[model samples]
Each structure stands twice: as structure tokens, then as C-alpha cells.
Target: MHGYAHDKDNYAKRLRRIEGQVRGLARMIEEDKYCIDVLTQVSATTKALQAVALGLLDEHLKHCVSEALAEGGEQAEDKIREASDAIARLVKS
Candidate 1:
């Protein structure tokens, strides 16, 4: 019943790719790669993670928050707050 259930496999694949990127980053460090190259890889990894986060946020809003709003009550308020908090965290990062 999870909001993201439909795209769970896609999410998993994206995460696995991110994991591989992280491993590559570690390997770069171990190999004493150029500082700028390492930094560029770090930026790419960060952007990939942000992309995933944004996708999840969009899904939550389109599905979970929309459903809660339709219900209209304490649950709706909670969902709004939860989504707001998530946005705040993303912004802070």
C-alpha cells in the first residue's frame, strides 16, 4: 500500500547505481586521484542522491499527501507537516 510501491524497482535500481558511484568514489580516494576529479565525482553523487530525493518527495505529494488531504483531518495535518519537514531537510542539505 506504500505510495512508491509502483516504482519500487526503479528506485532500487537507482539506489544500486548510487551505491556503485559511492564505491567508485572510495576507490578514487584510495588510488590518490586528482583532487578536482574526486570533487567532481562527489558533486555527481550528490546530485544523483538529490534527484532521488526529489522524486520521492514528488511521489509522496502526488499520492500520500493527496490522499490525506482528501480524507481531511488530523492525518492530513500530519502528512502536511511530514512533507514540510522533508522539504526543510532537503533545503538544509
Candidate 2:
């Protein structure tokens, strides 16, 4: 997917919501919420973080990788290798 730049405001808003979720999780822990409930929230937070990571990776591939490929040199190969390694780590998490 070729990514174009998105509005900074929207991205900030998304991050803010994720921050709120983290704070809520902390509060839940402090309040001694149910163990299962806490785990569920933790799962949701993990998913949210994964979503953000994937989005950034997609953007990098769409713009940076594409440009590197167009340049047609060792840089392009390096970027591909780096992106692959990052994706592997991401998936393992």
C-alpha cells in the first residue's frame, strides 16, 4: 500500500486515545479489578499497539521503500532487509 501523509491532528488523537487506554488499565489495576478483566484490557492494549505499528510499517514501505527501489542500488536491498527484519520482530511479539 502506497501511503500518503496523513493529518498530524488525527494521528495525535489516535495516540491520545491509546494513552487513555493505558491510564485506564493502570487505574483498573489500582482498583483491584477482576483478574480476567485486567487481562482483557491488556489484550486490547496490545492489539492497539500492534495496529499502530502496522500502520507505521505500511507507511514506511509505501514511501521510503518505494523510493529506495526506484533509486535501484544497494540502499534498496538494505531497506528491504531492514523492513523484513522489523516485520519478523513485530510478528513474534
Candidate 3:
């Protein structure tokens, strides 16, 4: 099973909420809402998405990476490299 399998429902709910927030943003633009207010909402949405990403990464390291390590050999090395790449992408974002 995937590392996030346990919290899959919560993740879907959060993503749905974020989707609503994005749609709200589009509506705000259409309504010509105050610039600062719209920007603030955008920042909030970004942070929410980041929070989800970080949570997934933490779970991955704790579950997936740990399992791979226990198995040993090439699988362990591949998991490490994959996790490293994920972290790099997150940092760059």
C-alpha cells in the first residue's frame, strides 16, 4: 500500500477545498475584487498546498523510504534517490 493510503480521504478533501479556493480566485478576478484581498487569498491557497505536499513527503520518508531501507540493496538506494529528487523539487518550488 502507498504511504498516504491511510489518509487518502483527508487528502482528497483538502484538495477539493483547495480547488474551491482556486475557483474563488477566478471569481474574484471576474468581480474585480480588491487587489490586496485577492493576493492574500492566493498566498493562503499556496500555503495550504505546500502543507499538503510537506505532509506527504514526511509520510513518504517515514513509511516508503523506511520500508525500502529494510529490504536493502538497490531498492534502498533507489528510494533514497527518489526521495532526494522529491525534496529538491519541493525546495525549488
Candidate 4:
């Protein structure tokens, strides 16, 4: 029913990889890895997450928002507003 549903498996796989990256980050901290190395990995992990977010946003725009806009009414307006709020949150993050 959702925009990302079609590719849900891919999304889940990516999230699982990100989860492993996070666990690795914790391990690095426990091992007292070098600051710069840890920071680099952190940046990598952050970028991976951002990539997933952007992908989902793209799917939302192409599927959900487009469908609502095609219908052309209150639902369209609501979707546009909701998408805008989501974008704002992502930008702030």
C-alpha cells in the first residue's frame, strides 16, 4: 500500500547493513580506536543512512505524491504538505 512497499526487501537489507555498521561503531569505541578513524566510519554510516532516506523520498514522490496529485483534491494538498514537512525534517537533520 505504501510507496516503498515494492522495494521493501531491498530497504530492509540496507537497513540491516546499516545496523551492522552501527554495531561496528560500538565495537570501535569499545576497543578505543583512533579518533579520526572512528569519525570517518561515523561519516560513512551517516551517509549510508542519508542515501536510504533519499531513496525512500524519491519513491514517495514518484508513487504516493504523484498518485495524490493526479486525484486533484484535498488528498493532493495533504500529501504535498506532508511531503514538505518530511523534506524539512530531513534537511534539518
Candidate 5:
């Protein structure tokens, strides 16, 4: 398993909630709910996914990046670069 496997349960729970949120959005559309209400839920679900992603990124920095840095070599630089790129993509999204 990857490093984040330890967080599987929590991640799964969050994802399930997001899934439910999406289904709720679909239901709202089917029932002709207010556009604003549906958009509000969409925003909430986006933020929820962002929170989970940030948590995973934090753990990677704390554990994986820290370990790489402690080794004091090229790998450390590479890991830092990789993490930076990943964060940049997340931010852009």
C-alpha cells in the first residue's frame, strides 16, 4: 500500500460523503430545486475534497518529504520538487 493507506478509512468516509453530496445534487435537479441551493452544495463538496487533498499533502510533506530531507542528498531535492509540483497542480485546480 502507498503511504496514505493508513488514512484509508477517513478518506473513504469523506469520499462517501462527497458521493452522497453529488447524488443530492442530482436529486435536487430532478425535483427542480433552486439553482442557488444546488450550487451551494456543489461548493461544499468541492471544499470537502480540497480539505481531504490538503490533508494527504500535509502527511506526505511531514513523513515522506521529511525523511527524504533527513537523508541529505539528491533524493531530498527531488522529493521536494515533486511535492512542489503536486501542490502547484492542486492550487491551479
Candidate 6:
């Protein structure tokens, strides 16, 4: 029922990949890999996470927020506020 339900499996797969990347990062540290190499992987992982976040936010705006706005009342306002807060959090991160 959530906005991302349609692509839940895809999201799960992406998260799993990210988890593996994190494990790789720990391994790199354990092995004393070059600092730049580890930092490069860190940047890659961060971008991947950001991509997933953007996808979920797009889905929320298209589905959940759209539906709430169509009803035209307090629910719409609440959803808009919630979405704004989410955007703000994303930006801060």
C-alpha cells in the first residue's frame, strides 16, 4: 500500500547490493587498502543510496502525495507538509 510497493523487490535488491558494498568497505579497511580507493568506494556507495532515496521520493510524490492532494482537504495539507519535511531531510543529509 505504500508508494514504493510496486518496486519493493527492486528496492530490496538495491539495498542488498549496498549492504555488500558496505561489507567491501570494511574488508578494504581490514586489508589496509589505499585511502583514495576506499574513499572512492565510499563515494560510490553514497551515490547509490542517494539514487534509491530519489526514486522513493519520486514514487511518493507521484502516488501517495498525488492521491492525498486530489481529496482536497486537511489530508492534502498534511501530505504536502510531510513531503516537504522529507525533502528537507534529504537535502540536509
TM-score of each: 0.98, 0.88, 0.96, 0.97, 0.87, 0.97
- Which lDDT tens digits does candidate 4 get at residues 1-93? 999999999999999999999999999999999999999999999999999999999999999999999999999999999999999999999
lDDT of 3 by residue, 48-91 (tens): 99999999999999999999999999999999999999999999
Candidate 1 per-residue lDDT, tens place, 1-93, comes to 878889999999999999999999999999999999999999999999999999999999999999999999999999999999999999999
Best by TM-score: 1
The whole-model lDDT of each prediction reads 0.97, 0.87, 0.97, 0.97, 0.91, 0.98
RMSD of each: 0.5, 2.6, 0.7, 0.6, 1.5, 0.6
Clashes per candidate (backbone, < 3 Å):
0, 0, 0, 0, 0, 0
Candidate 5 lDDT (Cα, whole model)?
0.91
Over all chains combined, what TM-score does candidate 4 have?
Answer: 0.97
Worst 10 contiguous positions by lDDT, candidate 6: 63-72
Give me the runs in candidate 2 sitting further than 4 Å from their true place.
Answer: 1-7
Q: Candidate 3 or 6, higher TM-score?
A: 6
Report the error of model 6 at residue 72, Å: 1.3
Q: Which clashing pairs does model 3 show?
A: none
lDDT of 5 by residue, 1-93 (tens): 355788889999999999999999999999999999989998998999999899889988988899899997999999999999999999998
How high is the lDDT of residue 25 in model 6?
A: 100
